[model samples]
Target: GLKSSHFITPTPIQALAIPPSLARRDVLGSASTGSGKTLAFLVPMLERLYLLKWGPLDGLGAVVISPTRELAVQTFNQLRDVGKYHNFSAGLVIGGKPLKEERDRLSRMNILIATPGRLLQHLDSTVGFESAGVKVLILDEADRLLDLGFLPALRAIVSHFSPGGPNAQNDRQTLLFSATQSQDLAALAKLSLHEPLYINCNKPGEEGVVPAGLEQYYAVVGLEKKLDVLWGFVKSHLKMKGVVFVTSGKQVRFIFETFRRLHPGLPVLHLHGKQKQATRLTIFQRFSSSKSALLICTDVAARGLDFPSVDWVVQLDCPEDVDTYIHRVGRTARYQSQGKALLFLCPSEEEGMLQRWKDKGLEVKKIKIKQSKVGSLHQQMQNFAFKEPEIKYLGQRAFISYMRSVHLQKDKTIFKLSELPAEEFAASMGLPGAPQIKLFETSKANKSRGGVKQPEVEVDVASEEDEDHENVAAQSKVSGPSLKSVRTKYDRMFERKNQSILTPHYNSLIRHSSSASESEEEVFTLTRRDHDLPEFGGSTSGKSRKPLISSEDLSKRKLKAGGSKKGLLKIRSGPDKVIFDESGHPTTFYEAGKEAEDIARDSKLREKYLDEEKERMRKAHEIDREVARDKKRERKRKRKEKEKEVSKGFFFLSYLPPPPQPPPSPLFIQKWAFQFKVFP
Candidate 1:
């Protein structure tokens, strides 16, 4: 079957790693992605299982740990195809599925492929999972798994297989596969492997690098012009299959909707962690089979997905790090195929990073843009007819959420809604509420303007008792003949009083309206007049007046005034609180029956409260259970639907009647007799 399927020779990695792995020796393999690494590990694992006569009763012989659920599913499918002739049974355990169902499926499988977090959940919750015979443990994309902050979970899981642990049964063979070898991988090997054999199929000089067939180029663009450049590139390659790598899920949806509207006839797909498992699976299958499609996604599609015939990989923005760049570019040019990668860089910030990459031996060249092509592409995109109604309304929520999340990042190069095009886009999406857009100006511009001054509004602080007096003073000032006349009148009034002659400080204040209209006017107002105070304690006879209270008493009063309302005690009202009753004795009861009724009522109320709380808790539990059950049912339905489709496609071939055999001619019979030396 391998020969018939055109598998004539093994790749370098496969040729080197398969033999040691088949011998049940722990192996740490470091090679770039698409170096035939999957087959290098999978073929040997199957052979070892076959040699052991692995069956359902022998328990699981191998377990593959992947970083992402998509990768795990891909690996599981490949393992099933390779092990079709054997008796090994494989099961997938990942998040977004019912734990109970996964637990049930765990009993009968000989190999399990799972993500670190989900597998740990099962090991901690499911009974008899640790006892399942797992002989060979493989960690795929080990660097990515650790980078995702799964080290603690991975440690907890590996502890179960320790020699002195409760679940330890046999010395397990370990295999670690990664594209790059970092300090983390070195530590991981010491913890997981026992003097493992090291296989570096990437060659001595070109180890830890991208494939040679992949062409790399970058374009330095203005921060605001990235979308324009990306649109041009995507439109230029509209008929070829490609994956556009973005930084976040928000960007994924944004780019997807943008291109989906610009090219409605094109097959555009999106993949991210937020999507449901089944939906992602269906999208993966569709894109794999699509001849010309566009997949806008984040780093989730960076590793382990084998997309066939991908012509190009476009980075919408500069990647966060070198490892990210390599993995993203690795998505294309798989299996020694020719592919191209384009990186969009902002000249002000990313030029340094680009130079660093070049210094590191990456053969990346700058792409010169044609002004006429970009202009024509932009015009074409604007003129394109958008027919999707959902795209018009979908990005508003995502945009708002992304803005809120990055509000504190202090990165000025990030896109802002203050730009005219962005504001229009937001308005078209039907975004609710007034969008708050703040534009950051460059330092050179600020220097040129000699530092722009912001308008200041001063607030006056006054006591509550003086609030009415301040308002009356403000009204009188406004009602005066004129500002100069009012000042003169206030001066005359203060001079006539001659009792310490209090004068108010005047200042001009401007208030701007919050209306969206462009023609709104700013309102200016003068400061309020000050109020006169009375002499202290009305001049006592032949003695100086003293304060009404001491400093200590004043502080105590303030403290009492500022006390919490909840801390105050309230008098209880009930028969139990009645110290004296209507009788001659000190303690006598006039109506004992009323008192008994009150006690009974209180008891009944307490019981009712408890019952209500219990009912609420029960309802909440029921709701959670119902949600889990619904998810399980939805997954089962999708699986059965997929199975039915597959079966129907081949069902006709399976059930078709044999073709009728035609009778042999006389001349053919004579020739047959002559050849066989016999007559029919």
Candidate 2:
């Protein structure tokens, strides 16, 4: 099979690591990616199983743990290929697949390949799990696993094969492999390996260097112009197959949309952590087979998946560190193939990291392209007709999954629908209808502001009754008694008395009232009045009453003088004097003569309405709680019933006579007699 597959010569890692691994010795291998490390461990794993004559009934012979689902799938494929001649059975366990389906196939598998998290889930949940018969354990991409915060999961998985664990056995061989060996990997080896043989196949000056066949260059541009530069490059290389690495899933969607719009006929795909496992695998297969293809993705695709004959690797942004940069570029120049890598750098942003790349023995050159050309490309892209991106329109189920993924990525328990840039993001992905987003409020502080406290108000926007009630309350404020009517009533109340009324100071009183009805209303009217009278400016006698100034002039003069001594002259309209107390919170009077009374009334009405609204909300919340509780109970009851059915189906088997016990050895019988004073 090796010869048939063209494995004529061993790679450096293969030659050094294979012999010991085949000998059943634990091996800790460190070699740069694309060094054929997969075969280095895979060949030996198959050879050992073949030598042991392991078969289906022998239980699981080996368990391989990968950091990512893609890698796990890739490794499983390779294992299948190597074990095909031996007729060995293998199975895969990862997320995004039906759990029951995977559980049903466990009994027939001789080798299992899985991601750490998913494998741990099965270890705890799967009944009759064939873990105790495992003979080998392999952790691929050990450093990447640790980098992704999977150390705790990895430890839990390792414990499954330790003493007293489900997979406990004496002949377990552990193999650990990675491109880089960090202190964390060293510590992990202490816990996972037993006096392992250390294999380092890295070249002397190739510690942080990309493959020699990969030609590396970078283009410097402004932050705003990166998309334009990227478009120009992709446009120029439409026929070339390549991968574009971005910093985030959002960027993956953005770049894919931009390019898809510019060249609607071209084959373009995107993969991100948030995508469904099945969708990701489909996209991966499609990209691998397409002759002229583009894959826009995040770091999820950076390490350890074999992509064939890639011509270019474009890093849309500077990678976080050197290892990431190497792995990304390594995706292209695999198996000594010639490839090009272009690093797009924003002006002055990551220049330090670029310098560090040079210092770390990587050969990188800056590729200069005319800014005018980029500008021209940008203009051309603008002129192109906008085509909707080729993203699938999400149904309700997919939309819920999408939202749940976004929330999980943010590590948020509650997410506000209004806060999500849903329309823009959805349109970029060419989703047809706007998502019906629901707002969830959480008790935690705002994470974006470094845990700053924020006030939260929960309202059910879905309730039409609540909305109508709010609308009615607002309308009543507008339609209630006009300020002019209140002023007229005040004038009527005081007009019966003949005593001359003075210029009133309306700023010295607080009036509180409700707008519900006249009977429920309470108003406190305060006015400062003067007893001395001044005539309107013609006759001095009381009957004519025209002595000082016009009514309009007197009013303006009184406003400008504002309770001053000069404005003390009384202007008689109606004849009742109202006095105000001097010691109270001062209120300003506007042109609306009854403004104070109106405001006081509105405040009381609002308070009453708010109380009623609170009661309604409380009732609605209680109903929602009850519904959720009922659903939970229904689900629990169904699960219990299913368990009972399964137990009943196996009741006859349980009642069958237990397998005959084997006769005890003399030593075991003597020990048992000593402990219990009885022996058979």
Candidate 3:
């Protein structure tokens, strides 16, 4: 039932390696990016796995380990597709996900795709894989796995399948794949292979072959000018669907922000190591499935992750080494398809690296770019001279939101719009909606006609700026105040105006906020009105009525006297909200000093407890030292006593030696001995 098209169109790596691989040969594949290396081995491996179908009792028959979660997930997806018609179930086990879920899924999977760390964790635990009837072990990105210091773990895992040993195997198959093979990989190959049929896809003197269907180009510029060059490339090469490789997450965010600020419609995604697993998966899925493709990422994304239709791979940062250079460009021209690889290099550093690459037999063709060759957006920015920033179609706020999102952040605005009700928008903006419009300050001449409070009047949209200026000026022109006081007042007024305009936007963007303060009165009342009323009636039902204070009254009291009892009443009446100081301390305007004292007291108590604990530890150490000294002395005394006893026994034996001098030998010998003894 296999399609003829699939077989005939096998990629170069596949064509050269698949047959030998199927015949159970050891293959050394040196294919570049976009080579059909995945399928080349996957097909043969799957065929072997299918042949070894050990029934439902056998959980999995094959294992694949990849460097990254994204790559692992991607490989798992591809494997799932290939195994679909074959009725084989595949499971994923990667970091940042529950191991138990993976363990449960393993029960149903016929194959396991996992990251190194998580896989090792599962193996060390009660989760046994012997029942899975695992017949093959594949280390995809074999070089990367070794580079990540997974050798000990990998050896431990391999030790489990030593035939006729504790974790014995029933005839095994081993496949190792990498974009580039190093010495460590060779050592690992020995451990995995038992006289494998060796095949090398990249022959000597073919370093820059680039899969025959790939085009490569390089641009030389200053380090400072690389971002500008990238922007130009992106604008001109809109047709290309691919990734931009950067050196750091910061750079990923920087490129993302730059492009987003230039063009809002560009659907660009940023992928990096620091992002949450779910977020990275969503980004990967979106880019993989959609046509509007431009992914900006680090070299962590350079290999084992496949995107079949990718038309370009732009290296925004110069490669770390020759192998990295190969891996970065290999992202394009994958799977036997035609693609392009572009490298943006700094002028100062290009010569040495270029020569090194050439010595390695790589021809990095240089491409020229002039200012005249700049794209539309860059051209416009270059030509237009202005003091203020140009007001473009995309609003400042929207552009900033996009920029933040590109930092691989979930844009608060996007989340806000998705999660909130429309009515909350007006309140978020600090303005009442149309139906609830209580006061209007539109006509300055007719301010007295509507019976609205003069000081509490809201400015109309057309005159809001004028009102802000007037208020700022008035606040600044304090006659009976010190210069510092006037400056403070002026700053406070300006800050208030700016916040009043921007708070709604901020509130709208926040997915979670102070519900007690931000929610509407109706929401607040509904949530608490009945709940606060007790089933058992309180005694204060008919107490003296509290005076209803106006907003103006509270403000006037605060200005006249910094703190008053009535101000406390006003604060208590308002919704609960935290007031933080410059140092991020929780404090109230009235109780700041007392709160500071309480904080100091708590800190002192904590230090005192720690000191006590340290003292106790010091005493315990002294006691241990005394005990050890006593034990040492006791051992020394016992040794001395034993030595004394041994010495006494030897001394007594020496004194009794000669045993009466051979029983006086003979009568004449005794007489001669007496004469000799007397002379001695």
Top candidate on lDDT is: 2
Better of 2 and 3 by lDDT: 2
TM-score of 1: 0.60
Global lDDT of each candidate: 0.69, 0.70, 0.63
- The per-candidate count of clashes, in order, stands at 0, 6, 7
Per-residue alpha-carbon lDDT of model 2 for 358-425, expressed as tens digits? 65677688888776556333433333313422334222233444444444333222222334544443
- What is the per-residue lDDT of model 3 for residues 413-476, given as tens digits with 9 covering 90 to 100? 2122222232332222112231121122222322323333323223122234566645644543
Task: Flag clash pairs in model 2.
Answer: 513-601, 537-546, 537-547, 538-546, 538-547, 539-546
Best candidate according to TM-score: 1
**Model 1 lDDT per residue over 1-680, tens place:** 34444567999888889888887788999888788788778888888888878778887778899999888988887876666777788889888888888999897888889998888998888887754356788899998887777777888888766442123467678889988777878888888888789999775665468987899888876544666666666667679899988767876886676666566456889998899988989999999999999898888999878999999898876665577788899988888898989887755545556565754567688888766445223333233314444543345455454444333223444333232244443443333322443222223223222344332111122223245335434744454322222233244333343334343332111223445233333233444334322223344344454434443444555536434342222112233433454574443244555665675689887687789999999999999999999999999999898777655645544454543467657776566445543421
Q: Which pairs of residues have clashing backbones in candidate 3?
A: 25-197, 26-196, 26-197, 33-330, 34-334, 34-335, 428-504
- Mind sharing the TM-score for model 3? 0.53
lDDT of 3: 0.63
Model 1 clash pairs are none
RMSD in Å for candidate 3, one decimal?
35.2
